[model samples]
Target: MEAPLVAALGALIAVVEACGAAVVVVGALSGGPARRARS
Candidate 1:
């Protein structure tokens, strides 16, 4: 319930969301072509 703790928690959530988004984008980009090749 402190300001610094709240700020840090928000920052951590943002970082996690960003990393997850990047991973999804990269996976989709790589999978699209490879999936087509196999099919």
Candidate 2:
């Protein structure tokens, strides 16, 4: 019932947070290369 729905929502939130963290790491890693190329 409501419990299952809540659990699903929580799982979705965790996945979104993980994706955001990965993006940040990737952006930080690539940012250096991009800046060097521009310069």
Q: Best candidate per lDDT, number?
A: 1
What are the runs in model 1 whose C-alpha is more than 4 Å off? Answer: none
- Residues 10-30 of candidate 2: C-alpha lDDT, one tens digit per residue: 999999999999999999999
Considering summed lDDT, which 10 consecutive residues are worst modelled in model 1?
A: 1-10
Candidate 2: worst-modelled 10 consecutive residues by lDDT = 27-36
Compared with the true structure, all predictions reach lDDT values of 0.98, 0.97
Best TM-score among the predictions, by candidate number: 1
RMSD of every prediction = 1.1, 1.0
